[model samples]
Target chain A: AQTVTQSQPEMSVQEAETVTLSCTYDTSESDYYLFWYKQPPSRQMILVIRQEAYKQQNATENRFSVNFQKAAKSFSLKISDSQLGDAAMHFCAYSFNFGNEKLTFGTGTRLTIIP
Target chain B: SQTIHQWPATLVQPVGSPLSLECTVEGTSNPNLYWYRQAAGRGLQLLFYSVGIGQISSEVPQNLSASRPQDRQFILSSKKLLLSDSGFYLCAWTGGPGETQYFGPGTRLLVL
Candidate 1:
């Protein structure tokens, strides 16, 4: 079984500043996918960024990027130029590379973008 | 563009009452469907997932059961509800296993 851990339960960042949310996972599977999801008060899950275990290069999507260290089993998300809209609960999830593998999520980190 | 719709946006029921939540997807076929439960201030927990019609995989052993009657429709049902079942239920779909999932607005169920 794979377990995801988000050591930071709460985080705050000033507007326009950068923030990094930490995530670590324990998985024996060599082929897997890692994701970061955001859920605001609306309770809708939004995909932030993704990283494949095989990819040595990190994944970046606009302001959101991931620092994936496969050897360390760490995948952290970095939000650059953070805005008030970035205030939400962020979750780190893991899944297999195969068909319909269910996602295992971390406890979550509540992010507050301070203005 | 694809979208997922989950119904009754909010629901309130008494303990031991029966429950049913419907979820449907549009603009996609043979997609993987999933049901998740979110407790207050907690991350989404995978309850059930379906890869095809009449096939359901339950991740957590709970009072709820899921059924995929059609390729694009998934339903979560409970014969008798429990207070522990009170939470936000979210429906999600993905193009494949490794693909990112798109989630619905979620149904807020409160069992009193």
Candidate 2:
């Protein structure tokens, strides 16, 4: 079974600073996908960023980017220029590259933006 | 662009009562759909997924069951509810396997 882990249970960063949330996974499959999802107090699960295992280049969306280390089995999310709106619960998830696979999610990291 | 939606934003039901949650997708056809449950302070758990209108695959064995009667519609139902079943239920969809799954706003279910 594939598993995703977010070592940091909670994290805080000052406004305008950069925060990197750590994530690692255990998978025997050679091809897969990693994702970071954000859930605010409203309980909406919003997709933050996604990284494909086959892609050597990492994924970046606006202020959100990932440092994907496939050999190390690590996928960390970096939030740059953090704003108040960035405060939320972040979840790391995994899915297989083929078949109708389900996403296996980590426990989540609660992010607090100290302004 | 495609969008996913789940109904009954919030619900409170007594034990042994039935449950019915609906999810629909717009601007997409024959997309893969999924049902997930997030227990308080826990990660999201995949309950079921469907690749087509009538094909449903369950990830975990539980009191819940899912059905896809239409190409863009999925339903989660339970014959009887339990207190342990209380949680925030989320519906998601993707174009296919390995694709980024988009989530709905989620429905909060509280069984007392």
Candidate 3:
């Protein structure tokens, strides 16, 4: 079974600053995918960024990026130039490269954007 | 683009009562659907997933059940609701492998 861990229960970042949310996972498979999802007050899950274990270049989407350390089983999300709207509950999720499509998600980290 | 929808944004039921929740997806066909439950201040717990119509897979042993009657419609049901079942239920769908999943607005279920 794969398990994702987000140690930081809560994180605060000032507007226009940068913040990183740490996440680690336990997986035996070498080929897998890591995803970061954002859930706003509306309770809607939004994809922030994704990293493929086979790719060492990492993944970047606009202001969102991920530092994927496959060997370390660590995938952290970094948000730059954070805005007030960035406040939300962030979750780290994992999926296998093969037939299994189910996503295993971490508890989550509540991000507070201080304006 | 694809859009997923879950009906009855909020539901309240008594213990031992029956449960039924519907989820639908539009602008796509033959999508893979999933049902997830999230407890208070917790992450998502995948309850069921269907790759095609009439195909349902359960992730955990629980009192709930799921059914997929149509290609884009999925339903979650329970014979008797329990207080522990109270939580936010989410519906998601993916086009295929390695694709981003689109989530619905989620239904909040409360069992008394």
Can you tell me which runs of candidate 3 are displaced by over 4 Å? none
State in Å the error of residue B61, model 2.
Answer: 0.8
lDDT of 2 by residue, B30-99 (tens): 8989999999998999999999988999999999999999999999999999999999999999987677
DockQ of 1: 0.82
lDDT of 2: 0.94
**Model with the higher DockQ, candidate 2 or 3:** 2
The whole-model C-alpha lDDT of candidate 1 against the native structure comes to: 0.95
lDDT of each: 0.95, 0.94, 0.94
Which 10-residue window in model 3 chain A sums to the lowest lDDT? A94-103
| Model 1 CAPRI quality | high
**What TM-score would each prediction reach against the true structure?**
0.98, 0.98, 0.98
Chain A TM-score, each candidate: 0.98, 0.98, 0.98
Candidate 1 residue lDDT tens string, B78-112: 99999999999999999886788889999999999
Per-residue alpha-carbon lDDT of model 3 for A5-112, expressed as tens digits? 999999999999999999999999988888999999999999888888889898999999999988899999999999999999999999997664789999999999
Clashes of each: 0, 0, 0
What fraction of native interface contacts does model 3 preserve? 0.62
